[model samples]
Target: MSLERTAVRQRAEAVLRRLAGDQARLREDQWRAIEALVIDRRRVLCVQRTGWGKSAVYFVATALLRERDAAAQRDAAAQRDAAGPAGPTVIVSPLLALMRNQVDAAARAGIRARTINSANLDEWDEITAEIHAGTVDVLLISPERLNNPDFRDGVLPKLAATTGLLVVDEAHCVSDWGHDFRPDYRRLRTFLGKLPERTPVLATTATANARVTQDVAEQLGTEPAAPAAPRPDVLVLRGSLDRESLRLGVLDLPSPAHRLGWLADHLDRLPGSGIIYTLTVAAATETAEFLRSRGWAVAAYTGQAEDADRRAAEQDLLDNKIKALVATSALGMGFDKPDLGFVVHLGAPPSPIAYYQQVGRAGRAVEHAEVLLLPGAEDAAIWRYFASLAFPPEEQVRAVLAVLRTDRPLSTQALEPLVDLRRARLELMLKVLDVDGAVRRVRGGWLATGEPWLYDGARLRRVAAARATEQQAMIEYAATAGCRMRYLRECLDDAEAVDCGRCDRCAEALFTPEVSPTALTVAQTFLGRPGVQIAPKKLWPTGLESVGVPLKGRIAPTEQALPGRAVGRLSDLGWGGRLRGLVGEGTPDGEVPDEVAAAVIEVLKAWAHGDDRWPSRPAGVVAVDSRSHPMLVGSLAERIATVGRLPLLGRVSSAGSAGADGPRGNSAQRVRTLHGTLTVPESLAGALAGLAGPVLLVDDLVDSGWTMTMAARELRRAGAQAVLPLALALAA
Candidate 1:
């Protein structure tokens, strides 16, 4: 071994001694692996799980490389010759947060290191300059950013020329079998091949099964080092899914207000930190405001929220200023809070993988944690909707392909017409295509550089096959009869398959059957009447007047009078009222014309009645009694109960629907229209009045039954008594 390698080994051994204490010194297999990589100069891939000490492998290897460089300088000095600058090591990470953490750790260890990300451009520039100058020893960057040509041509080539080690952290990203795969990762194969042959490469991750391990090897074009011996003593809890500390219940209500009430009750009862995962920003915002009205400290996080707002909300969560957080998928990744006691899914996650990842955030410290998966008819509808989006029409693909095929570079604006997509949406699709190398951006526009033949032949077939596989995985997750964790493990391969007894099915099977009667009934109803379609308006008591209650004269206000009147009524009735303005219109000052407001409320309360028929209006209806209204308090719970048991409904399209010009899945548009109709804003009341047809009302959540109730009444007044409501989840 070289003198420098020997010195590095000595230092590493000392560090290991300190860490291991009286435990046996490094195992023979470990020693052999280390020596081969450091002294003999070989690449290494350490496939291990969390707490496996994979960090030691690279830490020791870097120490040796540093020592070797030092010894070389000393030898050059003795010979009165100038020594070349030492090569700098590069570490490509998957998450910016992880990279920053590593940088902090290295600094504490007295090692020279720096990180590069969108957050620190000036620092990134300085670090790149230092790497070129041969002064920096370690550089950390996200794999996504490494795909940038400017970084590749300007910074990486210099480091590669020097033949420095390249380490890929969270290396599982290289595998399609892994849960997270960035198309940018595929580009690493070509980039790594460009590096000097002798330069060693090291890949590390906390989790990897056999399939993922093999894929990582293929992506790096190298054989993996012998894995460290399994640490059997490490506790791997495959306990029952029952979290005794968590009180579990499901509700079956027909309105969003009821869902909100359930949330408020939970907040009142628990009064601790929790997370509410919604399917959309509008839902998150509405839920947060509802909770706030109930005097709970709450905040919301979603893609639509400004970055500053998201940061503040996260900070509030960390600081415990807010007892609960309402969010979408945007809040899950990179969030760290050890004391979080609960994770409630207001809607079912898009896939089992997403569900697992979100739930994994809880109980990370092995302390008692709880998770709730709330499902509703609308939630199922949302899932079906997403499935439809995933399985886009072949025509859409053709249109996108045609845009990409333009010989000249085309800007998003120019391409939008061809693809029939808004500029923003077109950009998202283009990004996915770019990551797949199906298109390339040049100058101010995009160019169609993808293989044309591949577009139609075997390559396209392969892409389709992959999508089909993903679809199958989703279906299996939704319909599986066995353990959810095991299913996830089978699908992801990288995740451990051990049963987590905490999931609903597992807990029910192993511990107790806490299934709700309402949910079971709804599920049975759906199963029995698979072909039956009922309109939301028809479900309300007003539509059933022929059966029992009297159908009386109802005046429909003009659309122009709706907003002010609805806002006034809700505010007067103490329903946490706020009129989301259009353009710059302010809230109109006046009691909603009494007849219109009272009529809307009467219809809403009648529909919300738990009894089968509408109650006598003047006597049975209570004016927004926040305390006694089951529709407001138990809305989410009731919806959850009813929807959880319902089987998945097939996809439905919203084409030709009035006011449906926005993005297919925009929550804002859905909420605005649904709420506008529910509140009977004169502007919308007229449109709804005397309208008759089978209509489908889609929303993210059926929280309190109020929104759906009012919507049904408006539809009835409009002459359309058949209105079906579809939502992603019924908040529980």
Candidate 2:
């Protein structure tokens, strides 16, 4: 080997030792990746499990490149052109938690790492200036920022042109086949295309199958713009996906309450502090509250969780101060607690790949960690709700493009009237379109590129179909009589799929299938104690007037519905689970069941008779006529009136309602559909004539809340004192 090669090897060894103590040894795969980046200047894709030292490969590679660049610059009299900033390593990480963890980890190795993300917007200018001055060695950014107007057009191109080593952490997001595909990650292609030749890119992911692996590898190189540095062969290094420390199990509980009861009873018996994964934000909060009620030190976490709280919760877990963090997917990737001792899933993830990624979070550094899945009956329903948020149809895409087809750009807020998508979905669709070159995010907002964009319907449908298949695979994994770990491995397309004697199936099921009666009673009481406050809509949706509606700005307080209550939320893990079966999507509309009516009585009685009594006793009960669930709404109102000893006011007619499904539409269309839907009957007007207090406006369920809003307005117009919406459940 050349003397220079010898020196690099020595430096790389020294760097790894500092990062992971002197006892550390570079595995064959790690050495191959580093050698490729440092010597061959080739791009590499490393597919390995969590705790497999994937970060080490990039950090070490960055160290070698930065050192060489510094040396060449110091010998500037001989090679002055090589003396510039050495192009800081640009890392595209997906999550804030992951970036924070990585930045902290990098600091241990004497690496000066900084991040540019939403959480640190105030610090970005300083960080950016440091980068330009070559004082920052590593810069981490979220994928979404790649398409930010100023960042993309002004900042990224310069960074791309100069980035010495580009790392795509969580690289599976670049492939549709991966469980966590993010459209923003697709912008990597544009970034890759802009990079000069031989930049030595590294893409690392802990969750990806063979097909996803191939796709990510192809993306590791660049576009054919630089013929002088044509893309070299991608160095693919894959390690076994199996983690021996994980002892997997699946316990099939009869109901959501029973599952909670089990957790309440058994959480303390677990080995160490870890995560309790939930499928939704509501579930996370519900589970955390239940566990806390049982005297467990736990905190709820979700994507909506405040950043400071999230950091505190993370610290608490690391310090083993909290028993567990009941969290959504927000806590999964890039969380680096090596001694985490358990992971329990309250509901199954839709894809086996996603399941693996989450469970992989446990047993990473310990000799043993228990992983259990108490699959919910409502997992499929949650999966479908998420699936509905998939990429919009071809027509919606074209509409967005048409609106931005002028020289003048328009912000997403401005485009709301022109297009028919909710803000979140619209922004996401724009990101995908932006990546496809259909539109551009700029100083004002977005602009049309006039570039012909193909919708790729087949690709989307295939992804959807793949999701369905994976959901079934997860279902099978839960019910499989064979090995649990083996089934998961096979789903991930891992080459090592043989059964281990460690899982529930192989060990004759470790967890008991029963919850103690006392625990169940506590859980049931906690869940059944209901009264979910429905916050009244305060502001009229913007652009409603432009869309030919007369309303705009803050909603008239008188027109808004009074804060109301439902027995439970459909996303709740307790009574909410039962409610899900009743009013769930596709479940035929019907009258409220006798048992459910009893629960409603309890909720109403609590509102009127408990410490937090209703503002005023409802004078009477009124029904909102339902085109879909007339029997359910009518029966609900009649039962409440009969039980409360109040007169039954006549129902409001649904005759004024109008709209097509506008399938997969925005909130504006929902509001428009119910704008004039409620009209008071003369009988109802007469009934309200002598009413002295609020009227209970009963409906089968509340979703989007427009129906309730309009009904309340009609009742107020007809002289009702106040309208309180009561329902069996609220769709999250």
Each prediction's Cα lDDT score?
A: 0.50, 0.84
Each model's TM-score?
0.57, 0.96
Poorly placed runs, candidate 2 (over 4 Å): 1-3, 77-85, 656-664
**Model 1, span 164-197: residue lDDT tens:** 5677776767765555555566656645655654
Worst 10 residues of 2 by lDDT: 656-665
Q: Look at candidate 2 and tell me the lDDT of residue 269.
A: 77
Alpha-carbon error at 51 in model 2, in Å? 0.5
Candidate 2's residue-wise lDDT over 270-338, tens digit each?
899999999999989988998898899999989898899999999999999999999999998888899
